[model samples]
Target: MTVPVRPDARRNATPYLYGREAAAVARVLESGQYGHSDVTEQFERRVANWLGVPEAVSVSSGTAALHAAFLAAGVGPGDEVVVPSMTFCATIQAILATGATPRFVDIDPDTLCVTGDLLMEAVTDATAAVAPVLFGGRAVDLSSVQGEFDRRGIVVVEDAAHAFGSRDGSRPVGAGGTALTCFSFGPIKNLTCGQGGMVIPRSPQEAERLRRLRLLGVVQSQNERADITTYHVDSFGLRYQLSSINAAIGLAQLDRFATTERVRRRLWRAYRQALAQVDGVTLVDVDVDRAVPHLCQVRVPRRDEVFAELRARGIGVGVHYPPNHRQPAFAAWRRSLPATERAGAEILSLPFHQHLTRDDIDHVASELERALKTTGGS
Candidate 1:
């Protein structure tokens, strides 16, 4: 099979940059208004409108978005926030940063995302929030989960670190109907801003609170928009505001969203088609039609050996996550999560970037078959 190799396949997380990004940064530099100004605000608006949310507040990182969302929802020390064990450690760390305990729950083996049932089971009187991550861009069907959790007064926050341009049928992932949604614009995401995140709160009040919390707890009224303005400090906050420099890059990515999303979706579809015929591997359950996946992950036999083989063959493969429960930082919270363990032990991530071509997918599949039959592999 012909291999359409990436120019920079060695680095897995590098974002593709167009000249518009440089132009935006240059404009910011020329304006001399660098710290969270109109440019950054415009970027926030674009993302908010893109997600079909009323408002979105930008933060320094996706982790900060989670922390701000929890803090805005009144989560604090002693409160337990339920999340899946099969996510990036950022989810666990964000809860910890808010002085809340993270209760790691098992995921649905098919979707590789925590189910609402699992979250509900983990909840107790101390439970204040439940964040359902869109595992590998797989949309979480929160319809049933939200109503039940809402009755119990549990706050649901959708973590879309891997599902930026994704939609669930007709609705966008973070749109008005669902709970508050969070997105990461980290270098490897479907959309990247070098490093940034946002919170799509439900109401104007929630947006205001998030804005204040993100900007060192100051009043986020019109006064703060000026170059130098005095605002009353209401409470404690963190320096989690996204800078103009980062937003500029993100805006560039957003400008070309249609093209990028089409490419990403096409690449993923090619992987699904090719992998369907391969033995000893299967995709996690997801609505591929609506999913603009951030990675093309497949559960393969002898995952580690395959991972090594792909790396040796010059393919940038990764494990989306290693299950946060087993991490040393959450050692005390560690426990058996059967489905999560299954996913962690067998999952292999292949490159699924906007730059990938159908030939690359075929090359990867052809190479993967060879690796799966080697010694110590199934």
Candidate 2:
């Protein structure tokens, strides 16, 4: 039997839970070890195995993941990181946390991702790294220019926060072992650990460095520390370890990710088909065949008015982000990004979650069509 849509299409996004999530959390609570424990390590191991990688380092949040990655890659004061101005503010904030200056660049309006040419053009002698955000779960390929980046000693730290199960080609997003890829299991991501993130390191040494960084520079394991009089502080770090409680939620979610992938892809395709009938809307291409889509975004004329109209009609609509270059906080790093600014003004995210039914999608599309007409955008 088909399940009815939950509530109205008023939530732009929400965490979709499997039946096992509660029991998994309860199991962790009953174990008494709430901090980084066996469960947390197990979650790490499972994530590594799922990605077909040697190891995965768990951290507190996606921001922490990026910060640790930059620190581990030796991105520090005076070093510049090239990034897209169209991404969420968190991406830029993480770069600042590393004491690196952001050299903001533009994105392809179609994919909302930085191209190899854009990244290469932005790189200079002081460029320490380039962070390509896999916006809306579409992978950004830098293979054509990867050798040049390596020659220049520029690390590739991918913000795969929106792309957990996505593919760069045939392999999974992080499975290629080239870039230091970060994944977020935040509340509304493809997978939810309640709030957690993982970093797939390029090497074992890098993986070890990440572990120490997340654990406040502690060299000893939780069990090892328990038996020791004092543990050594190896270097600078943060209290960014993923907790056992959150890891439990992640393990439960990971077990059922196949279903999650299927449902997300199906819903995204449904939106594409439905939105095809709606005029004056361009659905952002997520390459649904290879991506487990994280958002259903569309560009529209008269976006603000159309957004207001949709909200008034009880349909959820939102903007993914405003360009960070235009924000007061990052104004010093600002550059003229015509494409990003134009996209920022037009982009609107529609209601997208596993809770949505086909009827709900149709309702949103129908409302959007009416809104465009009312706003004189159609």
Candidate 3:
């Protein structure tokens, strides 16, 4: 007897490459201009336009973008940056990288984002910034919280790794925020550039500072001559510049973003409609009109057992993240985060992407229903 292999639930065809991404890479390769070049500039312009911001700086990774944002925002040692405990470790690590403490805050179980009430409680005299993470492509309403932070002179940085196309009201995620906003273009993100990130500054001054910081604090002189170098290092900086090759890919990804987002929303609705009646499972509340739906996540009982059952049936499932405070590195910050802990244990990410079909969703729903039944949920 032979064991049967289930179809891969994670299968995606061609990976949604940008139309000109390959050409851009090939152009760079042929020109031998691998470092930051005109292509990078073009990519920045495109991203800025897309977000309706004045400036955008491409970086090596999303974490790098966050670190740079912290520095640009003047968050330093001994300062505390309020962050959600339910977010990925990168958000906390970025604060640590800036020599700042990550003060963990609880999340809203309905929205899966840091609640304003919880954030207010966490704010202290030592607090320098608040990073409102947009989880699973859900738009976080930072407008009201922005006023609170502004009154206290606290900066608000958006951890929009999963929110490339997320919008609040009529504005995009990166726009209309007084604080710095960071976006990820990682392979798994809504937008893919293999591995890249960007920082959208609130002003031109911030943008200039970020550009210098990205390239080792080196500012170019007007002469454009290497012999007459002006080695002015205003502040500590890091090498977080994105390559032209990656920018080309990013540009391509941007072109197809609108289509991909549409597909994602459709899939999310399909899941909600199909699994609405499933016992012990509740879909996250999201504003489909503004959100792009990065991942279709839900709170379910017996999450581990359900995850295992899905895997056994050739369905690929995922957890958005574990509580960041619970990580060993942040043990000192690990206090009781009831909502985060509960979400960690009960949340399950169903297979959702541009490639998933209606049939695929049906199969997932069937497997999930069976899993719930197996766990004694009538």
Candidate 4:
């Protein structure tokens, strides 16, 4: 098949850098105090202000953020965390890191997110927490069953790695002050910090707990530790602190978040409009009006064949995930999650990033339609 090349569509996802990122990193490099310095704290404060939250704790990675949140919430051995099977493996790994088993739940296939009803059905007496994956940057609202969770003393920790700038109703995802929301500033996420994460805690106490957890249980700041001969370890923790280098990149990215938000939404909508003309393709809704969408995905017939065909044509099509419940590593806790399994087989993530143009979206949609027809899907 002769397919016209689209260079922009050759990348599934790439960081969109504002001009200042290089200079920011240069400054951090020159400072020589890279490990969790004042710059890291500044980035946390800036993020909290942007999210309209009281505190945001910086971490080394999204997995570390999840691990810290699980530990801070008192989730441990003999406990179960309710989570969607459609999320990244890191979410499941984080649960296991806490010595807790994951009670895999199904998602609303259209949104690729676990609904309150699904989570409620999966919760048992052994359930210690519920970690909802905000797939494709769409916020998962668990408000309908909040009272039940409260009554049962079940903590809500959100794996909002894809939802950094998304909104739930009038407020941003982390600003709700309900769940312990985590955001990733990975290379391809809406905002790039090269690699870093943040946890938005519900209260000052939880914020302190997260801070301590990221810094290997140390109660003193780096400067304070330098002044004192000895530092105190208050609890069990990990070396998950976000370094000044990563924080510098994040701070620069944050300075241009409004542009990032606008560009991402526009790119997502372009894909939506173009994909509409392709038969047998169901665009997984991201609630784009309120979301700074992180991925443009679709449920297509013969997804594997379509994925292969797109790749052959140099279109950057990929799968968001294969259901975690079906993975061998998580076999012991796996259950029959019909919705998640079905979506796993059919979902395809298209090239999504700030770098793609409207023309790139059109080319991807056109090539997708052709691939579907060639695969006897349309």
Candidate 5:
């Protein structure tokens, strides 16, 4: 797991920077407002309006966003949160941070999302919430399970880290009124704010609580940066406030959506066309025109072999996940997830970013065929 630092072999495997990102940082630096300030509030308002949400609470990271949402939802010791095993470990860790149990659930194999049926079967009297992820930026089909979640009174905390710009028909992913929806602005995510996240809260009350939780539970306003002598602490909180500098970069990235999304769409379409009937390889319906993808992954029979082959040939391939249930640290939370286990073994994420050229797409596709041949895959 320890990859030696190889500065010389740097690969642009994630969403690369647009020209204005540095300027954004510089503006924040020169303003001398490094702490959480008006710029942070401005970014939150823009994000909330963009998502059509009443309140958007900006935080330190996507994991922190998830943690804050869980706490706001009252998920604590002894409560169970049903989550898909086919997701990042952050989902499990976020729940654990609240002293709650994470119940691993299998995906629907086809959509690679936890279906309403699977979710229904996983819950119990102790179930407090279900955090469904928009995996690889694929929109989760919530239609089937929305009724059940309402009837059961289970809070839906959508993990929309990958679904930042994705839309459902005409509605944006985070705009829906869920208990909470989290977005990431990590270095590798579609939108980068150095390292930050934003949570679209269901109510103004929850929004206020999240703001308090992010700054050591000290209930204070942004204007209090000038007069911090007076404040009140209600309960436990953490130092999870996103700096103004980070928020500036995020604001800049939001402005670049028009150009950045186009590059992603073009390259993603190129990959889709090039790999169209490769024998043993299967791709999810990325619908790049509609969804802004964070990764372009495929399911290949000899995935490990293919993963190694591509990387050996200077192609930066990756694995989106190794099922949460299979992790030794989360052994106590283990449960049988056949589809998740099988998919984890076969999933392969190819190098995807605005930096990739059409030639790069062809090369990756051609090399995939070569790898499949050597591994005895059709």
Candidate 6:
């Protein structure tokens, strides 16, 4: 099959198994119960076990996971959450959804995550939480910020959408932190469920609250509530529960996650080896042995030109994000995020997926090298 020039626009995951996924959907259709049910609950338990968390609340999307994490962590109106300006717009949107302000922080140039210094600088009297996203599956030094936040009594919510199966100092992404870590199961993620996400709470109480909040504040119970016949609203909530069908897909994906991760690591290594000799290109910082990279991003001077050149040469390249602060919606909160702004201009994500072959990696590297050469790279 001829691969599309742009990776993002192409079907990279399990192209041969489209029929099987269709069959799964068909099975769900035959079942007739489409919304939250036993399948969703099973998937939640499975994911919780996978993350080694007490509970995992499946949600409609990764954005929902963020919103739920913020709410469950007691973030509210007039509060501020420190977030890296270098992330996707959805991160900001989730903060805004909670009636909280997102205080944009600069990133560490090497790791592409919120730096300890920048995070400390962004903290203020109104700061309620600090959300550090693990960019491109690399483990960030959040320990320092965690210490600072602990001293100040601030909540930490990890945006681990890119770091599933990743470890920080021998602990899993969601483990050993007071933060509520969220994972994405979007189609393009390391483990996809068509469209879904999960929040791994820091405590059982928090996890219970998340579960309740996800399902419109309906607390789970074996016996029906005495006031089940009456209307009661103890707190605000949302309709963010994941569908059973999506959960089923997530379970299937989880079963294959280990094998997929191995393939992805090999592919990433091959790319790194092939592109290592190229000048004016620096790979993102990642502890290869511990990190199960979700994407391969590089810092290149002429990112746009190289991206366009790669596309023209039948290679797919993607931009992880444009600075969230630069976006019109968050412009009012925008400040001088030098590292984030610079990285936004320099970062380019190369094609990466479990399905990509060594030949594909070679093609991508060769095309990237040519693109850089043509764009006047030294």
* 1 against 4, candidate with superior lDDT: 4
Highest TM-score scorer: 4
lDDT of 4 by residue, 220-240 (tens): 988898888999998987999
- In order of appearance, the predictions have TM-scores of 0.94, 0.98, 0.94, 0.99, 0.94, 0.92
Worst 10 residues of 5 by lDDT: 1-10
Per-candidate Cα lDDT values, in order, are 0.82, 0.93, 0.83, 0.92, 0.84, 0.81
Instruction: Pick out the ten consecutive residues of candidate 2 with the lowest summed lDDT.
Output: 1-10
In order of lDDT, best first, we have 2, 4, 5, 3, 1, 6
Best lDDT goes to which candidate?
2
Which is superior by lDDT, 2 or 6? Answer: 2
Over the stretch 236-344, how does candidate 2's per-residue lDDT look in tens digits?
9899999999999999999999999999999999999999978799999999999999999999999999999888877878899989999999999889999999999
Q: Write the per-residue lDDT of candidate 3 for residues 61-169, one digit (tens) a residue.
A: 9999999999999999999999998888889989998899989998998888986778888999999999989898877776667788888889888899988898878
> What value does the lDDT take at residue 250 in candidate 1?
91
Give the root-mean-square deviation of each candidate in angstroms: 2.5, 2.8, 2.2, 0.9, 3.3, 3.1
lDDT of 4: 0.92
Candidate 5: regions farther than 4 A off: 1-12
Stretches off by above 4 angstroms in model 4 are none
